[model samples]
Target: MKVLIIEDEKELSKSIVEYLSEENYLCEVASTHKEAMKKIGIFNYDCILLDITLPDGNGLKLLEELTNENKQDGVIIISAKNSIDDKIKGLQLGADDYLTKPFHLSELTARIFSLIRRKQFNNANKIKQDELEIDLLAKTVVVNSNPVALTKKEFDLLIYFIGNKNRVLSKSTLAEHLSGDFADMLDNHDFVYAHVKNLKKKLSEAGCEPYLKTVYGTGYKWKG
Candidate 1:
């Protein structure tokens, strides 16, 4: 999953990004409210870790704006403010969960997983599409009841496709989802084609129904 970390504390933000990246999440950091606004205005993320106090503006206002825009992205407030009013206000403004600072990283990770499961996957750990099953927490996939050995990129690609089933995904969008916002700095998207090809071949060889579809003149889609 992709995540945006909006925190003014540079060290904390960096640590969070590093930890989340180790957990197989695409992470980006925004040190100030302006940067956070720019990121939310441009790219999409599966979840956002928002800090209520920023250098420029209060993160609560941004949360309210997100609510007005009807953004489906999951949001978690990571702020030092532990007042009941702040918690109630954030929840009222559509924040999924609130976590005070000086907490365990594992707890934060678990919360993020819970939020994603609740918002995107109907609170299910295993996602099933016909004969294919994906265990989001375990980061594993089974085709026809057999485990499919996939590279990290291949697994991420498969998860992305399944999460957005039946929706046409352009190459660029897929690349961004897999590589994060920095994907645009890449010279080419040949890596995307390579990973997609490998994923499709593996699924087919495993006797799984072919679900990855390439849209002519566009990109690819996962169809049930």
Candidate 2:
């Protein structure tokens, strides 16, 4: 998943980014409200860790803007303010969770997982589609009782497709998910096609029915 962390504390933000990146999450940072706003305008994030106190503006105001935009991204307020009023305000403004300052990184990570599970996976660790099953923790895929071998990108692509199974995902969107910031540096999205082709071949070779479908001029979808 892609995450945007809006924390002004450099050391803390770096630590959070490093930890999440190690877990295979695409992460970006915004130390100021303006920077965060620019990022929110340009790219979509699965979740956002927002600090209540920002240099340029109140994080709560930013939350208000995000809510007004009807952005579907999950928000978790991370702030030094331990006031009940702060927590209540954030929640009433559509924040998904709240974390006080001096919190353990593990706790933060767990909260993120919980928020994502509730937001995308219906609070489940396993994602199921027809006869296919994926263990989120194990990072493995099984189809018809047989394990399917998948490279990192292939696995990420498959899980992403399964998570939003019925929606048509564009090549650009796939590239962003796989490559993060480097996606903008690429000249073409041929890598996405290559990965998809390899994944399809592997699944087929493993005797798994291919549910991936190309939509002519648009994109691809997993219709299972």
Model 1, residue pairs in steric clash: none
- Ten-residue region with minimum lDDT total, candidate 2: 202-211
TM-score of model number 1:
0.97
* Model 2 segments more than 4 A misplaced: none
User: Whole-model lDDT for model 2 versus the true structure?
Assistant: 0.89
lDDT of 1 by residue, 113-160 (tens): 999888777889999988889899889989888999998889888878
36-92, model 2: which lDDT tens digit per residue? 999898778888999999988999999999999999889999999999999999999
lDDT of 1: 0.90
Full-model lDDT for every candidate: 0.90, 0.89
